[model samples]
Target: MIEFVFHTDDVARVRFAFSPLWELVRGLRVLADPSRHALHLPWVHAVRPKLRGLDVGFLRSAVPATDYIPDFLTPPPGTPLPDFAAELEIVRATPPEVVAEELRLTERGGAAGAARRAMAAEPARTLEAVCVQLGRFWSAAVEPYWERIRDLLEGDVLRRTRALAANGAEGVFADLHPAVRWHGGTLFVDRRWDYRGELAGRGLLLVPSVFVWPQVSVMVPPYQPMLSYPPYGVATLWESSPAAPPDALAALIGRRRAELLLALGSPASTTELSRRLNVTPGAISQHLGVLRACGLVTGHRLGRRVLYTRTRAGDALAESPSVQ
Candidate 1:
């Protein structure tokens, strides 16, 4: 069992902000009579544990722990995060669109396919605990994302979120996060998901909410958690990035492969790339093979699919033709 520490101060802050958030949620529950409400219930339920996980992450980050998840996966402390109203509207804006897309996914092979693949990734008990831990660990630091969304989500979303903020106060959670409670230090935890075997055997992935939001998420080898609320017809679809350090690499190597690299900028499955580039999987494989050999690209295995990413070499190649 993973050891967990809870601070009294953290609890007080959480109770302050969360109590009201819950109240608003309860108010939203009144609309349960509609089909859309039914659709949303499961997502709300699924997010509860993740939200709590984020809160725990925030607390741990404050202790200045060495084991830290990346900042993007978890929100930074003291950041004014997005509240429910904004999220509700974001969902509403494209609710039908998302629903239709999900339905289409189901028509093909998607979450259900992935979930089925993930079943044996860990022992049943371990799997259940991980799911719980994922949520508990995440909520502690879920704010930065909320804040990013708050600033980015405007128009219809802004109006509704502001209305809720007016009722709940915009800065409600400003002081609720543990990061704000204690002295500042670098806080991180392992948000990376681990599977015992090869990624392909278990539907491997990395889902940065950014993938969906800012579209920052990329699938790489080494499985990332799979979030689901099938009952609600909500499923996340991610394009995987090869786990070759695009961030570090993109900066290190930025020019030689600029055209080839940028052409491959969006996340993709091996098969998808083959089709898009008008190349055979084997031909694409040859290019990726050479790239990987040169450290110019990296390959990540996800659920029987391999996603290729441009490595520092590739990024450097992109950075300049003179890098060589």
Candidate 2:
């Protein structure tokens, strides 16, 4: 009854917003404190559904398997893998460039990224593989009413909303820290174990699938890898889950910051957040500049415009009780 309808084009928005939007959700979960995380839901409600669909849909695609990510939703600890539609876990961490380095074909026609392979001979096997991957995501957090979910994922407004979630190009890859890069689409990565390890160095942990498709593997970093994986229990999450960090960075900042924080929860043009908050756009920009300096905010581009959001640190600061 959540009435989560979205325009068909919004799904394209999800594809565009695939990255930043994932970080936003992770940031929200990290800044779990009520006052700090209190993003006016109703205000978000007024956002065009196509745009809202992009936010919601991108998050949906980004969720990791429940077993590896405990807080997400899964069976009890020490329980069998029955909870997962796909039975898998990384028994070993592969090293960097594993995907491109060790490319092997399950069949013909290049790799997973090369486009749909020749599967006419084994249509049933191909169909089975697709089902397994779909089931894996479903078990992770796929909705009961998937058709609606799909519709929400795919919307034109979702595409336009890209400045907030995925398509924004800003500091997206500005890290010396080596990354595996498999998580951002472009597949057939599983053949190379080294690539798997590469992502881990950058904090992305892949949950391997026993039921192999051509090259489908579920990746996990931190519950909030989008904001630069906080170097705490990211490794122990699946191998051994960690008690949620008390110093969860996003859980810290105060009221004014919290309001600004929530206002920027998704990327918003300065004019947008200002208009929403009844403040001048210049005033909003000033606050954002401060937040950015502290590593608590980031910006993205949409044409000549820039959109802003709570950085991982910003979310943490906003959520935390004021130490000051």
Candidate 3:
């Protein structure tokens, strides 16, 4: 179990941010183990051939079979959200010794080990190559959906932060992950490796990921400590087409309301629904307002965005029989 001891100051310092580089790294996992992360399967299929041409040696080492990932490869996000270029620069500028050490820990031996050794020999040159490949990968696979991804991530943070505010630390930690627990001023994270760290008033960074589902992870130490958890609505992040509304439900509440109900299979912001339906946000809001009034949908404030999701009643309605 990994334990993060927090002080009163540490609790106040907790913050949320997004990592573009981290997404690129986790996207590699989707590539390596497509079966495990089926949510990303479509993305993997689309980008797989393009990836065959890139030098993925560093990724092989950086993201190992085990949950442990090199912290240097994915540095803690800077305050707010670090841009992909800025974060890549941080990785590229990592001290050679730090890079070698992280790679050695995760790679151990085999092709991954060999890749690390090669990188250690000429750190700057090889780091540049790794960065270039990552940049290209991001543009092809991630940039297109970054806006939607960002909305989901930010919404996750908003909901969690509100929980913390309303119900205190216990409320937030309780649902953070099944593997996480809070007791005696320390937060425990269940992991294969053993780790214990003190916040020392530096606080903990909470990041939401679309691809890092089924495993809640933390960056290995000697880097700023942070945890990455699957966000609230990742299951639908890659949904290519909105689900068709049930015919009976469409007849009952108009096609637009039925579509809105089906879309809320996961929490989504007005902007997201608008983009998905190719309608104006105002139109989406009008429908959402009606759904909210009828007790079919609920909304929560996440930062400036309000994400809406189906109420239990709404779910039943969506699943009700279609007109014969």
Choose the strongest candidate by lDDT: 3
- Report the Cα lDDT for candidate 3: 0.78
Candidate 3 residue pairs in clash (backbone atoms < 3 Å):
none
lDDT of 2 by residue, 18-93 (tens): 2211222333232222233233232223332324223332222222221112122221112111222222221012
Better TM-score candidate (2, 3): 3
Can you write out model 1's per-residue Cα lDDT over 82-137, one digit (the tens) per residue?
34444333333433332333322332243433332233233343233433443333
Give me candidate 1's TM-score against the actual structure. Answer: 0.26
RMSD of each: 21.9, 18.4, 4.1
Ranking by lDDT: 3, 2, 1
Off by more than 4 A, model 2:
1-14, 17-255, 321-324
Q: Estimated TM-score per prediction?
A: 0.26, 0.26, 0.81
Residue 208 lDDT in candidate 3: 88
Tens digits of per-residue lDDT for model 3, 245-285: 76777889999888888888767889889988877999999
Count the clashes in each prediction: 52, 26, 0
Instruction: Return the top candidate by TM-score.
Output: 3
Give the runs in model 3 whose Cα sits over 4 Å from its true position: 65-68, 107-112, 220-222, 242-253, 261-267, 278-282, 285-324
Please give the CA lDDT of all the candidate structures: 0.32, 0.33, 0.78
